[model samples]
Target: MLTFYSEGSRLRQARTELHDGALVTPFECPERLDLVLKQLRQSGLGEIRTPNAYGLAPVQAVHDKDYVTFLANCWTEWVSAGHKGEAIPNIWPARTLRGDRIPRAISGQLGYYALAAETSISEGTFEAAMASKDVALGAVEHTLKTGEPSFGLCRPPGHHAAYDQFGGYCFFNNAAIAAQRALDSGMGRVAILDVDFHHGNGTQQIFYQRDDVLFISLHGDPEVTFPYYSGYADEHGQGQGEGFNVNYPMPPGTSVATWMAALDQALARIHAAKCECLIVSLGVDIFVDDPISEFTFSSEDFTLLGKRLAHAGLPSVFLMEGGYAVEAIGVNVVNVLQGFKQSME
Candidate 1:
């Protein structure tokens, strides 16, 4: 499998994050990607390459135009306003805050467009995120054009970001942008299977009202996971998308067995959806020792995940999302890819 990456992605690293009531080094650090790449090399499945820039046009296809502008200028605006620390949101448009108008101030706009506090930006965040989106879109283009699989190694993972709202270590939803680009480029029925540890609330929000795209996710149950809301079993799609959305919210400490069972069921649903292409929001944080996730999957179990997805028999693209098991992330991710490659043969 070809791995899509960009060096520019490292420009936006946040120096610290508020973790456990104290400021600690960010778990979503640049070293995490480095460790993952090292593991991929050690595993003998290392195939990596950078992508040609796809520019802002592909991004605008799935993101709100004004929201796109906000992300591009957010860091500069924050710095221009004299705040120098990491750009974390201090407020959000909760149940009471007016949602109709976009705010003029950087903080108000940050709160207006964000859903949670997990995502923080530094001076160079927007460039890195846009480059990351390009990485994912480049992979999608390769898969769509050649009917072969490619992996997008994006940082500041982007499943929690919606069309307009950006948070959860995401500025723009890369996988959603790629999936939407696939749809626009003529894939009639696309299936997005988010196998990340956290629910892809942002991806779901974008496709929940559309019948052409099917969204399925397996994540920690919202009852006990981070972000604290959404990801419920009852969040079925609305209107034309009613039967197309699927969510498997497993309990904490879920093992490989239970997780695979959920994945099997998701595969059945994807098959029923008659999906012509598949996009996997692959996050290795489900590994047993991952700090931020609850599922207790081993590194080797990722192979089974890849094999199972290959059985679905569709053109596929894999987008990197969350995973804080920096040490083991590469192996876990490659195990799945090698497993799928074997199954494909």
Candidate 2:
């Protein structure tokens, strides 16, 4: 399980996140990556390597060009507009408002492109996002080349982003970008299994109308979860992608047994799809102690989850997503990798 990481992730140092009604420190801070990296080194799971530069082409593949341009220039535009503090959206185009037009004002633009108000943009957000996608692309290359599992320790987790919208502490959809790269590299089919606490809305949106790539996610039910849209049991794929997209949305305090049952069903769907490659949107936020999410998974349960994915026997790429429990995130993440490695042995 080779791990791909980038020091550039340190540059995204936004200090504000809107939760409930007040601004507080972001749960998706840089320390999460530091702890995970430390555990990988101490556990001797595999070598931690810096990712190669893949540039914006791979990012543009899954994200809109204008959206990518907005992310790159958002911070600068906000600063130039004389706004104080990190860039956060206060307004959005709701159902009756005009969403087809792009706003000239930076504030309006922020709302126009943002899906939620929790994430803020700072000085180095664009650079760091670029590097994060590079890390994901590097893992895709490693998995394709070696036919072995690899991990992309991506910061600014990206499952919540869409083709043209950014939010949920994510600017660019790393897992979606990686899946597109895999398809571009001549693979017939690829399946993404998102075991994150929140639904992978962006990844599902990207492949929802396509049959070449299958998207599946098991997460907290959107009825009461963070992303309060999509992630329902009946929102199956449309047209050519019918029956390809799967969602197993469970309630809060979902037992490990129930979650594992959903995992078994997801795995069966993946196997039936005959996918040539597998990408796991790995998130440890489902841990019992996580601040922002609710689930009952323990550290040992993560190990079992990893082993189950390994048993599926497809070339795997693991992309890091949400996990705010700074103290135990390392152990839980490493447990998954170690379990997969040990299972392979």
Candidate 3:
């Protein structure tokens, strides 16, 4: 598999994350990518290359234009407001609140566009987020050009972002953007299989009403997980996209067999859809040791997971989402890629 990455991705480091009603150092930090790169080199899979510049057009395909503008300017606006220390949203438009109205204050805008308070916008957030989008787009291009699977090692993971809202350390929905790019590039249909530990609320919402892309996610049950508002099986899509959205929500401490069972079902759905392209929202946070995620998947299980995905035989693009087990993250991620490579033979 080819790997796409960028050093600029390290710039979106947030100084603080609002967790459990308190500020703490973020779990999604720059070092996560370092270990992934180290393991990629050690595995001898492929060289990590800088991504191609796809620009804002591809990114805007999946994200809201005004929201994209907000992301690009929020950091600067925050700085100009004379308030320091990474911009974290303190307020949100809850039920009964007016969401249609855009706030003029930078502080209010931060809250308005943010899905949650945990994702803080640091100085270089917009730049790093754009670089991450490039990584995803470049990986898609690699898959298209080489006729082989490609991996986008995206940072500040993007599963919890929505069309206009950003959260869960994600400023832009990289996986959704990649899927859209596939469709825009003339692919008949695209299927996104998100195996991230947390539900890809953002990706699901991006295509919930569109039939061109099918979004399936296997993640921790939203009933007791982070971003606890979405991810139920009932959110099967709306309008022309009905039945295109699939969600497999498992309880915490879910066993590997159970997880794989869900994977098989998701794969079957992808096969049934007859998707022309595949995008895996690859996240290793389901590992037993992941700090913020729960699931009993051992490192070796990732290999099997990858092998099964490879069995599908679709041209695939893997986009990194969330995996905070910093020490073992590299080995786990490489295991999946290596497994897929071996399976392709």
lDDT of every predicted structure (CA atoms)? 0.86, 0.92, 0.89
Q: Where is the poorest 10-residue window by lDDT in model 2? A: 226-235
Each candidate structure's TM-score, on Cα atoms with residue i matched to residue i, is 0.97, 0.99, 0.98
Q: What's the lDDT for residue 12 in model 3?
A: 80
Looking at candidate 3, what is the lDDT of residue 249?
97
Tens-digit lDDT track of model 1 for 1-345: 788888888988687677777777778888877877886677676468888988898778788999999988988899899987877888876788777877788988888887876667787788889889988988999999989988888986889888888877888888888888898898888999998888999999988999999999999998989766888999899999998888999888998898898889999888988999999999888888999898888877888889999988999999999888877888888888899989988
How displaced is residue 215 in candidate 1, in Å? Answer: 0.3
Q: State how far residue 113 of model 1 sits from its true place (Å).
A: 1.3
Question: RMSD to native for every prediction?
Answer: 1.3, 0.7, 0.9
Candidates ranked, most accurate by lDDT first: 2, 3, 1
What are the per-residue Cα lDDT tens digits for candidate 2 across 1-345?
Answer: 799999998899989999989999999999998899999999988889999899888988888999999988888899899998999998999999998888899999999999999999988999989889989999999999889899999988889889999999999999999999999999999999999999988888888999999999999999999798879999899999999999999999999999999999899999999999999999999999999999999989999998998978999999999999999999999999988888988
Which residue pairs of candidate 2 clash?
none
* Model 1 bad stretches (over 4 Å): none
Clashing pairs in 1: none
Candidate 2 ranges with C-alpha deviation above 4 Å: none
